[model samples]
Target chain A: MAKDTMIEELLDAWEETYKKGQLTFWVFLALKESNKCMEEIKEFVERASDGTMTCEEQSLYRNLRKFQNLDIVAYDSRKVSKGPDRKYYYLTTTGEELFKRFVERNIMIFTKESIINLLTQ
Target chain B: MRVFTQRLGQFAISALIFTVAFRYALDLSVGMKSFPAALVCSIVYFGLMFFAGWYYGSKDAVENEIHDIGFRFHFITYVLCIALGYASYFIGWNTEPLRSLNIGAMSWGIGLALHFVFFLFAQKNAIRGYVKEEIFQ
Candidate 1:
């Protein structure tokens, strides 16, 4: 596949997810910036929801709480602030490494056809 | 219910927050006040309100239109109050010794109180509408 084709596919997927109103984009974007505490994540979620997150939306956030549940993400209550006990999540080293790989792979797959055609002709 | 009132509320809240924060940050009551400081703060606060309100308003037209309206009206009022307060502080400091401090303190107190009132009005009006829309929809 050409690099442009791969990029197009990724964008299409993103749009689809957005239309579905999934919480994944907000979570992913927030994690991209920094290792956020739970409070911080909640604030970002509230903001992204445009001050309107349905009960379902809130539940979706709760479901994202486990690392074993989603291998790419990890949560640690100990590393975060003490008092009243709250868990904080951050992308694992492997998760960060995988995200980079995912980007590179898509780019290579999309661009490969052009590169190959150029080389042969 | 009117669009103007809605917008007024938003602007009032933003202005209040900006004023209170600026006053606290500058320690205007205690410090040797500078005209430049007051002028800069007022400009920055109004500019922020305009830009933020516009950006948020564009997201969803009907909802934001009301917010923008409220914000604009409140902002104008806020600017006037701040300008008056700043001028009084400037004048007092130049004219009198101990009296200047008292005048500055009073100005800051009035500004801070006005800001708090605006905040309450904004939170009640601006956020409530959006929340209701989301819930009912």
Candidate 2:
């Protein structure tokens, strides 16, 4: 029991450190899939991350706003069936290019044969 | 623009509160009881200042995360406090306005200058990689 607890604590610390700024990546991936409202984006992120990541609506909103300011995201006001107009957000061309380069440089390396073999082993 | 307007509205409300409180406190403290009244006024003013700063800081944190409301709030506080302090003296409400204003203004001015420097440094760091127009565009 004590060994299990120790391992769990170490994993938690490792995950915390590893996951920093990863929300940005997941959020971009969601937007890259399609133009989505905030709710849709939130759902997509949670589902796509295989339940490994969860984010508060408030933090998501803040990230979206920052992305908008950075010209990494843009939104269209769509008239929803209920209530006020909802903003459907999507990546701008700049954002798409940025994400592409980021993935190519940072994410795609893990898919290398050597890395995959090492991981599987 | 909308965010700026929202912040301006919040600032205006705080300024109005300060003006009213300062005037009322000064009026309450007449000749013989002036010292105690001034003391009460100072307490009230500082308290309101603290409340306004915290209240609006939190509101801005929630609503205006992109903008640096810290520097803006402190800058406004310095300006308003100095203006009010001197205005009271000119209007014959405060007799020793210079003495009253000196300590607070000097300390806060130094703090505000530091805040401004920090703001500039943060701005530089934010734009280090990207062109300003590109980011905005």
Candidate 3:
């Protein structure tokens, strides 16, 4: 499919996951800044929430780290800084593909029944 | 309710222990001779706990309480102990020994040892009743 179409589908999937408590808004934001480094990530996080995150938000970030399809990295940005000044990131091909698929599927799976079932089970 | 209060009390005790260790290891007194930096550090430590308690106390009734109390105790005690060690080094920068190896060793050793003990205890107790209920029901 077209890249735009794929991106939309991934976004739709993300929205569904978010409603189902599988994904969080902060994860989406981090995914948006997949190309940025550690410092950039920090800046993005700070800016996104007006300089602070609650414990839940922090926990969500931790959960995002466990997603098998995502490949966040921390490497030295040769374009920006030299040795000893590395940057962190989270933009791998697998992450990109997963996100695309998520958006394209447009699965309407985040219903109250599904959520209750998940919580009870 | 009892568990919540007990955990809070434990956190308070740990904080007090850390504060005492910090003051002694760093020669910080509360009188007129006390350094402004020491006062600021103490305030910041308590302030952090206050905010942490308020925030976590209101989140998920069970999860937040456990996390908040656990995090405050561990984080404050560890940070204060390390800060005291580092501050001792900076203060004694021009002295004969140049640093208080004894203070650093004691602070780090006690802080880390106690942290591990408390961590294990908390983990063991985290889901005791809840897990049983969930499993049986």
Best by TM-score: 2
Q: Write the per-residue lDDT of candidate 1 for residues B9-78, one digit (tens) a residue.
A: 5655665666556555455633657767766765776687667566544543443323332444544555
Clashes by residue pair, model 1: A2-A110, A2-A111, A3-A110, A3-A111, B7-B69, B7-B70, B7-B71, B8-B70, B11-B71
lDDT of 1: 0.55
**Chain A TM-score vs. truth, each candidate:** 0.47, 0.96, 0.38
Better of 2 and 3 by DockQ: 2
TM-score of chain B of each: 0.35, 0.71, 0.36
What DockQ number belongs to candidate 3? 0.02
lDDT (tens digit, per residue) of candidate 2 on B41-106? 778877887887787778766665534536767777678767777777677773455776788778
- After TM-score superposition, the amount by which residue B82's alpha carbon in candidate 1 deviates from its true location, in angstroms, is 83
Give the candidate order by descending lDDT: 2, 1, 3
Per-residue CA lDDT of model 1 for A17-95, tens digit only, reads 5545344445655666777765676678678778553235444454353232335578766633656655567777766
Poorly placed runs, candidate 1 (over 4 Å): A1-17, A46-58, A78-83, A101-121, B1-137
- Against the native complex, each candidate's DockQ, computed on alpha carbons, is 0.02, 0.09, 0.02
- In model 3, the clashing pairs are A9-A102, A9-A103, A9-A104, A10-A102, A10-A103, A10-A104, A11-A103, A38-A88
State residue B32's C-alpha deviation in candidate 1, in Å. Answer: 99
lDDT (Cα) of model 2:
0.76
Candidate 1 chain A: minimum summed lDDT over ten consecutive residues — where? A61-70
lDDT of 3 by residue, A1-121 (tens): 9999999999888766554542334444565665555445556666776654322445543444333212432233445455665444554665566556765564435546977699789
